[model samples]
Target: MILKTSKEILREITLCDHCLGRQFGKISISTNERRGKVIRNLLNCLNPELSTNFNKQKPCFLCDNIFERAEDIVKNISPDFEFFTFHAGTKIPEEIMKKEEMLKEKYGLQYQESIKQELNRELGKDIGAIIGKEFKREKEDVTILLHPYDSKVEYVINPLFIYGRYNKLVRGIPQTKWFCTRCKGRGCAKCGNTGKMYDVSVEELISELFLKETKGADSSFHGAGREDIDVLMLGNGRPFVLEIKSPKIRDIDLQKLELEVNQINEGKVRISGLCFVEKEIVEKIKNTHMRKTYLAEIDVCLTEEEKRKIEEFFLDRDIYQETPNRVVHRRADKTRIRKVYKVLTSKENCSSLEIYCDGGLYIKELISGDEGRTNPSIAELLGKNIKCVLLNVISIEEKV
Candidate 1:
């Protein structure tokens, strides 16, 4: 620090408060402003004081004159951004950093700090004070941007996520609207340019309404698992997360979203226990299959008396199921052994029964016996064939 004079330094290099201060970064500096001031003050004190006090205003090379207007930049952008927390994203002119490196060759520059870190600290502190929001570094909902030269700042707001559970009361429509398989959503004659197999889906009904109400451009829906279009999902529904892209309003009532979504679906789908959540929860819900219960109306080809044997197999049994023929296209033809958690006879005379157990259990294959793919199935145990007439997801259980 004592090796160079202010006039010599200013003559050799032009440095802003941040750039000059950063050169002494390893000096156990407390704050960016303090470091900037100290570095300049060292030059002023160590060297003879300037006649016109121009040394005090020596511009930072890396940050240009950005440090001179740090407070003004933070103040200018705070009005538009109103969040409980914020973080700064700094951008330094690349040439300025390079120039500092070149000057370091001739003069002794030690313990330096980066102009970017300085701007981040100074702007973050000043903005945090002006608005009572904390600087959330980990998962900030809003980010503050500073253009130190022109004292310009911009704010970026993160997307909002809402979590909820949905129950599909009726069938026929898919969990998510299906794109036309023939056109692959490109809108051929089959899809009529709508590019979908159906007009709308349970997901669309809820997400569309959310986008409208929240003034959001788009919304994405994520569920724990999806049931087939023909299958109905019941009981505690399914955990889902809906991300509102560029949400203009975050204070909307969840109860209202639930009501509006359910109403739009016309009772076709029901939602409950809705709440706002962080984006990370969506991932948890997607992978957590937990446990599920299914109720299927089995159509037995057996006589009434032979159907009675179905109960005996359910008392205690393990069923080996190869991926069913229907899903074989997507899933590998591998065998899986699952236990029957419980069984309830819906109609003894009709030879139909309900089975409850873990999720991902193939119900139709269990009844038809999956062409001998499923061992110890109701059809196999009774020594007669059976088919599932109506399959319904009765409930899904997760750790609340």
Candidate 2:
């Protein structure tokens, strides 16, 4: 029944082997094009008039010979590609697509593939074979857009991720670059035509090195948590991932890059454990619970006995802290409970003491009491006015 139907179709309209075989692709004997050639040969032996009148090499009436251009397109674009995976796509004329639809309806062909899909598949296979790359259906690294006169090859360079810890040494530099409020990154006179509020940032110091090495178009910095602009990030530093976008070069010597970045930005910002990682690590680092240690220097008129009492008050206690008034403009005004696993106090002077507390606990608010917003705070417990002179993140203990 299939062979007879194929011969009848050949007698009625002109179709190449691929188009004819595509009709019976649902049977899955082999490839549709091969099955089409097999059917054509059998029909030629049975009916000489059909073979002479409607040649198998002739342009398909439905597709209009568009599929035959795949090879020439591949060979032409071969010199421009150095990609690993690709997706092929084509734009066919509306009239040709409508004619194909009409033929499908007339022949009651429910199992046939569209000319566009078959064209992409055929071209993708041939191109993949020549380039020694796989044809990807989704998340393609490269995309070949085929049109009648103009064709384009687009490269989708996947983001390169580097996981490490960054130390922000300065007191005034922000973790990320702050664009000018006046122009919003477009150069303006208010920002001195720099398109930035500040000339230097932790993100710029770290990501600039990577952008130069990878030859990437842009970059984004993802930190586990950020410290205030006034606060210094010391000790082991804070966890972060620098996502390099559209990186032409992925293979890099991370150890050497780390050394170069640190040497360039020596006293400003430094990165450690510089290694390549997957994109998912960015989300993981954001969502994961991390325990941190901070060293806060507070100035208060307290004696040795009073400092001991302050240390005893915070140990193994849950500090009910409301959002500080300083950050209320940006953060939601809500009370949150954070655990103080241990509190270490050292008397630097008669008016200064260094205190170490757990992560997520607002150390400055704990000292000042934030106008009675933070409960069981050092200021509230000691009944003394305490002000944080300097705050620094000493360590960040991340869960494996």
Candidate 3:
């Protein structure tokens, strides 16, 4: 009785083999098309009257024979990609879905999968067989979008992240590239028509080398903190990340690349501890609250007694530093409280001091007192004039 009723239902409606088979998809570990054939064969054995009509009728009341176009789409996509893994997805029309749901409810097929899911799986199987590649649901290199109008292939290139520490060996070099003041990167005689204030920068040196190695289009530089153009970075160097955009090649020899960069920029800039990283490292490094150590050589018009007192004054004290006049044009005029952990003075050559403070503390202002803008500064403590002639970032603590 069940077999006779199924045959009557098949004869009544216009269902393609795929959709008809999907009505019984959960019966066995077989394809919907195969199940449809099996069901039709069973119906024929049970009922001889409707055998000829069952073999002749061919239509799908739900999809309207859309599955027949899967072959054409597969052929069009076979030569479109050269990727290790891919996934095929479909965007079915609302009307087709409504018809499918209507049929599912009418036939009480609550356990069967949707038409779109089956189509995507079937298409992926066919394409995978031809291309000899596995299907990746997540982190795919390429995705094939199948629509009623056309099929489109999109390559999903993952961004490459590299984390390391860099040393700006020489002075008068900015962390990132600076455009020329005269032409503003448009090129002018005042800047030697190079459109740059400096011939090279830390970003340029590291980014160019990375771009070459990865065959990437471009890159973005993220540093834990920035140092002035005249400040040299020393010690274990400063942490940074290089985000490569649209890299064609991902597997790279980081150690060899690091060696090449250090060799090329021998005395200018150098990077160490090069390693492949994920995107999350960039944000974590940027928002770090690591302590900083700076070595500043200053010229103070103070006696030995005053210098001694000034060095001991900044130890374990809080400074209310307002925005310095020099950077007031760009930075907001506001006050910020910073902590000074230690201040060590050295009178060997030109009166230098190693100042350790919380991150984001303006060391230059601390020495100059920014004309009394910064309270309890070295100048304020000594009650005399002081100027930071040369500054060097000695070390930065790791926070990420």
lDDT of each: 0.72, 0.78, 0.80
Q: Please say which candidate is ahead in lDDT: 1 or 2.
A: 2
* Maximum-TM-score candidate: 1
lDDT of 1 by residue, 1-400 (tens): 3325334666666655555556666677466556656656665675554521235465554555776676777676744523566787766677866876666665666556556666677777887888777888767777778776555666677778888888888879888878898998989999889999998788887788787777776778888878888899888788888888766666687887788777777768888888888888988877655577787776554555654566655864677788888889977988877777767665534655668765667888777887887886777777666788888887888663
lDDT rank, highest first? 3, 2, 1
The all-Cα superposition gives candidate 3 an RMSD in Å to the true structure of 4.8
- Score candidate 1 by lDDT: 0.72
List the pairs of residues colliding in candidate 2: none
Estimate the TM-score of every prediction.
0.85, 0.84, 0.76
| Candidate 3 lowest-lDDT run of ten | 51-60
lDDT of 3 by residue, 1-400 (tens): 3354467567678667687778767766788888777777787776677752344345567766777777776776643323566677877889888887876677677556688888888777888887777788876655667674356544555567899999999998899888998899999999999999999889999889889877787898999989999999998899999998877777789999999999999999989998878688998888876799999888854566765786677788999999998989978999999899988876664487889998888999998889889987887777778899899989999656
- Candidates 2 and 3, the one with greater lDDT: 3
lDDT of 2 at 155: 46
User: Which candidate, 1 or 3, has the higher lDDT?
Assistant: 3
Task: Point out the worst 10-residue segment of candidate 2 by lDDT.
Answer: 148-157
Scanning candidate 1 in windows of ten residues, the lowest lDDT window is 47-56
